[model samples]
Target: MTAGASYHGQPVIKAPVWTWQIPWYFFTGGVAGASAGLGYLCELRGDDALARRAWAAAMAGICVSPALLIADLGRPQRFLNMLRMFKVTSPMSVGTWILQGSAASTAIAAAHAWFGLFPRLARVAAPAAALLGLPLSTYTAALVTNTAVPVWHEARRTLPFVFGAGAGLSAGAAALIGADPATAAPARRLALGGAAMELATTTLMHRGLGEHGRPYSQGRCKHFDQAASGFLAVGSALLAARGSRSRTAAAAGGVLLLAGAVSTRWSVFAAGRQSAADPHAVIDPQRAGIARGERIGGARTEPVARDAAAPAGPAS
Candidate 1:
């Protein structure tokens, strides 16, 4: 099938209705989740100051996350309504609870570290928040892949890792914004590690996507993807060279890392939208499957037509 071939040349699927707020929500939610997880690890290592800053970063990200989600939803109540169910099969339902639990636990942990409150609750909440953070960082990948969007669905296996890397990068960058060079050492390491992982996983994801990945490399979508990679690379380089010795370098690198992470989310979201809008994104994949003798939708490769005037044959 050619690109122009479809049901009368219309899109095979509707483009997503999501807007700018969704990408922002993804970025912040990722930062919150990664920060919580990193904070717990730092606490276990007895790096109290670094852990405190991490919790604070988690608090800040969580605060922005819900507001962005609510804005996208057009109402605060709609966000709350998602928590009404805990369906195991639904990514959105599971993610909603993860966000809620992460927010509450981070808040408790942050309060204890910053204001000296809730000492007993903080111990349990801290670990709980860290545990929830892993899914919270990458569940958006599952949510999008669960849909019919060709680009997203094709990259499902690696998207979570890419998202997790972005989360770590952004959280580390946010943490680097404050504190001395010595205190920011761990954050720098996290950011650099995330940048490397993101670069590797993203390359593999695009390679695995084959023709379905066109949106990420063509038109305006290409620019966003390039910017994401560029920012992360430059940020990581700067951090490695001077982040441990200079606060100024660390802060600037941190800003670039955040920009890179945000751009990564935006590029992925835009690519999915573009793929959904293109008919060939859906048609070409199925046609290839048919060529490979793979049954589509568990049905036969050839269409079966019945004659209304003739007697119907018995079921096989």
Candidate 2:
């Protein structure tokens, strides 16, 4: 099978039904997760002011994430149904639980930071929230790769790191806004590291996919992907020079980093949709697998059909 060939010249696999809401949900959840970790680190370092700011960022993301998820679910009521079941095998179930726990923990940490209430309990809650943030940051990548979509599934190993880097960039950028230069230094360094990691992983993922990555480099997705890489590169460079330059330069870099993070997610989603819409993207892998003698049952076993066409005798 090739991209030019299709069933009745139509796509074999349907494009994913997900919309912007899902990507936004991913972005917000990721930011929330990273912010929680950043806040915890600040607290451990005894920078209460910086920690409060970081927690505020986490709170902002937490407030918006559920709305995005519910909007993606199409009905607010459907969101409740997600909690009605708990299945270990289902990523969605696991994600729902993670989100619920993260929300509660983050809320407590944020409250403690702002009001100074629950001083005894806050100590426990802050670190717990940060611990929960670890999985919260990377689980969305698992959710994406677990789907049947070829582009996402093929990059399963790399996507988690990519998303983690993106989350770090977002959280760091958020932390830098309105923060003192001295306090923001750590965030700037973190964002720089994130940009570097994102670039490296993205390059490896593209090379790993080879021809299968065409959709990401072509058409609309191509523009977004290129833009994301460019912005991240420039932003990280500017941030690296923050010591020599004014705070304005670093702030601009932060904004650009955030843009790059958003663009990266959007591009991935768009590329996956393109891959799913192309019939050959789904069939070619199976054909290649069959050629390599991989087991494909039922209608997918083309070699079985070929062998069945051979002439046979009935005597034996």
Candidate 3:
């Protein structure tokens, strides 16, 4: 709200710039995402302690950040206004409710983990919340996808997958660093899952975005994202093979994964800004569409719809 206090160093634009809450939303997503894997692993091993800590950290995150989100809202009071306009189509409302449910379910699971009054009940809550947490993590990514930000809005097809993978890795790192595993098997497992997802997602996103991936490839965001992608791959491989039995390898893997996750988030934020800061990403495509509009893959206007049309074709 300060005069020309927008975008820091980036160029001014016609549309409203992203808010701080956008990035905070990214963090909560990671917490929620990682919690799910941790919970699943816990349930698999019957290690209630790990599961409880994971859920507690995750739930605590979900509970606290929604309040932060409200505060970050341009109209703070308008935050609760979401409940009034619950649209299945709106990521904001969907995410809001997901956070609420995720928070409540996580709390219930944490209680079960702590109290030990009913094993059967807790078992149900853990998997249920874990399932929800996966989507809860990247609901914000979907929110960004629906936006008009040149790169982000268009990259909607792959953004959720990218962020979701980051969330999974973050959760793995948190468990590894925050908890001392007897054999580091859990940490290694998480690293492998996170690494594989991150690499695959990045590859697909780049291919899908094509020229749109320019900012991501060349800008500050690119540096961090590239590093994350590399670290994730290397660290995951090392952790998977070497750390299964080595305590120090697990510790190192935790550090690597944390660094990778940090870079991943920072890169995404920077890429969104860069993509919007310049007109080349947005205007050129549309302008050129005027003279010689070749709808490669799909039209410039209806990428999502065209993508949807693919499955429809087969179904019909």
Candidate 4:
């Protein structure tokens, strides 16, 4: 154990204030962003039926996402206040605008695709939505990682990919519902690829986190992680084997993938909170850096002795 590391054995950082809604928002935002991109790809391929379904799913996700975010803030006005100014340096600021743009662009594209209105606008909006979707889908990873949280900051390299994969999995799964065999192939491929990538990236994140990954591997977070992996694995297998031929199989696989997406977000969020609640999660890493003779914040790691002239404080 490092000397002078503990402060009454208490956590140095406060746990995140975000609640259940944030994870749901993350899941839905990812779905909305990925679905828009998938829809545009389907449109380019002249698969209007599949494109419409993807856009519709994007619309549904974007619509639900804001409500979840607003609910988390505990006031619609607080959410609106975020739109008052844009800060390129702030992940939260950029993410808020991305969500807003995604909501509008997706709604417009879905309307045109579904109701056959404003073809010219959709031609412009569809590709725009797809472009914005890339950032929208993965920006939440930046938001969480920008904080002092050990688990999130340490796994920053791969968490975006994890979130992106979860988004693709959920979006593709949603599109697979009620789609015919011929038109469902693309969605099935998307879902399968997403599930595989999600599993791989999540593993990579945990491995990369090293000692800081305990929150992900132990206790309640471990269960969430296991559920995510199991669901993605089973769902992908089911989709790969029979999804193309059977609508029922496709729908079932899609449902599992959606569940996996939710579990992925929940696991990541919970792990970050758990890490924050554990003081050692912060201290040990710094101590390890000091042991390596690394300078932290340009300050020497050597302990400083108290001055002889200093006055003593009363004990608590």
**Which candidate has the highest TM-score of all?**
1
lDDT of 1 at 18: 86
lDDT string for model 1 (30-145, tens) is 99999998898988988888888889899998899878888887566767788778987888888888898999999998898788899999999999888888899999999888
Residue 170 in candidate 3, Cα distance off native in Å: 1.7
Model 4 ranges off by over 4 Å:
1-5, 297-316
TM-score of each: 0.92, 0.91, 0.79, 0.92
Candidate 3's residue-wise lDDT over 44-146, tens digit each? 8877666766766676666767776887777887776878867878888888887777776777776777676556766777777788888887777888777
Number of clashing pairs per prediction, in order? 0, 0, 1, 0
By how many angstroms RMSD does model 4 differ from the true structure?
Answer: 5.0
- Flag the better candidate by TM-score, 1 or 3: 1
Model 2 residue 215 lDDT score:
88
Tell me the deviation in Å of residue 166 in model 4: 1.3
In candidate 4, position 225 carries an lDDT of 94
User: How does candidate 1 fare on TM-score?
Assistant: 0.92
Q: Give me the overall lDDT of model 3.
A: 0.71
lDDT against the true structure, per candidate, is: 0.88, 0.83, 0.71, 0.89
Query: Model 2 segments beyond 4 Å from truth?
Result: 1-5, 243-245, 300-316
Lowest summed lDDT over 10 consecutive residues: which window, candidate 3? 1-10
